[model samples]
Target: MTTFGAILKAHHIDYKLTNRSSLDEWFYSILDIPIDELSIFDISRSIRQDVFLEYVLPRAEVFLYEDPLAGDYDGQLLYDISMLTEAQPPSIMAILKRISAYLSQLDKHNLDSQSIKSIEKISALVRN
Candidate 1:
């Protein structure tokens, strides 16, 4: 099934960004946090960026619930991001908007327009 990993794979989005010192630094800050205590509230307390979402999706279950959807990386690709963006940190949602390019590049056949707009609106709320 097309999971987050699958979609990212389609885009050649590197899952191995830990090799970059900047990404590695921010990644570890979140990664090092105790997952058990991790909350959307706390996670966004530090830094919020589109890159971070990409960085965190593979690792979301460490803190958030495993993807509720049975398919698609169990929901890391969209659901958790949906929830976090919906929660409206404003800044977080703003950061999320940065993924627009990636989302646009995603094969249209893989995601329907309605779903795409839904996500766009999620991030756009901060700008509006």
Candidate 2:
């Protein structure tokens, strides 16, 4: 009876607090991903591997690449995704692309701030 909630916990990703009956339903609705070809598992992994690769860039790939829910997941991840797949098959590549877009934007923001800080430090040294 492995559940998606258990899987998310193993990954240190907590489900957001919601007033809805089912947190999974709430999360999926908020995400509003238009799945058409790929599955949720595929999307999650791609988000970990190719998409958010650098977002989680510092972590070991084992926790992501092989199986994010492999360790302690009950079977909920599969069940939830199965229910979702009933609606529409998602495009695996498209999901990866979408995740990549968000990750790249985040990386740019982080890098820009870091760069500015580094530059400020260097300028202060020159002044001294």
Candidate 3:
């Protein structure tokens, strides 16, 4: 998991970021401070745009819901980020573009109801 993902997990937001890289330990070390005291500024300073795009964005699920194809349901990564975008480190347009590209390439028929709802939520983000 990427450090950013770990941060969300620490906050009780369960989004799985599947990038295992050399910098993982270095990033993890930054969290030695109490999780409750960690601020958005601290997170922004610790992570970069490249890391957010490459390691975090791709696997960020839109919604977490109980469905056979949906895996475990706990939280929505994109939704969580969207809710906190005012304090988010990465550019909103960058996030929107990446999500657009992902949706464009996806097979709509393969999506479950929760996934569709997830898509809807993200689409709402675009409108906003």
Candidate 4:
């Protein structure tokens, strides 16, 4: 059977089965709120890039951010960054740029066919 962690990783998401305590600490510290104060659904609201720099990344040994398929039932992509420590800031800007570029392409579907082709090229570049 595929482990949950394996499934997450297969989709380019990061996870650590052994790091729940640290994850909780990083999450609480970043949002300036206790872990118990929020539900899992509330977690995404706290994942701003600035908050990541201030609280979690600096202390983390390693970290990753993923852009999973939209409407993915599993929260793996969004939650993966909490595994990082405060000392190990990941490339948040790079991740955000990639995500923004992807979203921009997705947003261009309302355009004409020629514009859609341009968007496709942009999306391909972002993937690379």
- The TM-score leader among the candidates is 3
lDDT of each prediction vs. the true structure? Answer: 0.45, 0.35, 0.45, 0.37
TM-score of 2: 0.20
Q: What would the per-residue lDDT of candidate 3 be over residues 17-68, giving only the tens digit for each residue?
A: 3456645654555534543343443333332333443333433423222221
Q: Candidate 1 regions off by >4 Å?
A: 1-75, 85-90, 112-127
Tell me model 4's lDDT, rounded to 2 decimals: 0.37
Candidate 3: deviation at residue 67, Å?
A: 15
Off by over 4 Å in 4: 1-40, 48-50, 53-90, 108-128
Candidate ordering by lDDT (highest first): 3, 1, 4, 2
TM-score-sorted candidate list, best first: 3, 1, 4, 2
Q: Each model's TM-score, in the order given?
A: 0.33, 0.20, 0.37, 0.25
61-96 per-residue lDDT for model 4 (tens digits): 122122222112332322333332233334644443
Q: C-alpha displacement of 67 in model 2, angstroms?
A: 2.4
Q: What is the lDDT of residue 76 in candidate 1?
A: 33
Q: Where does candidate 3 stray beyond 4 Å? A: 1-71, 74-90
Residue 24 error, candidate 4, Å: 11
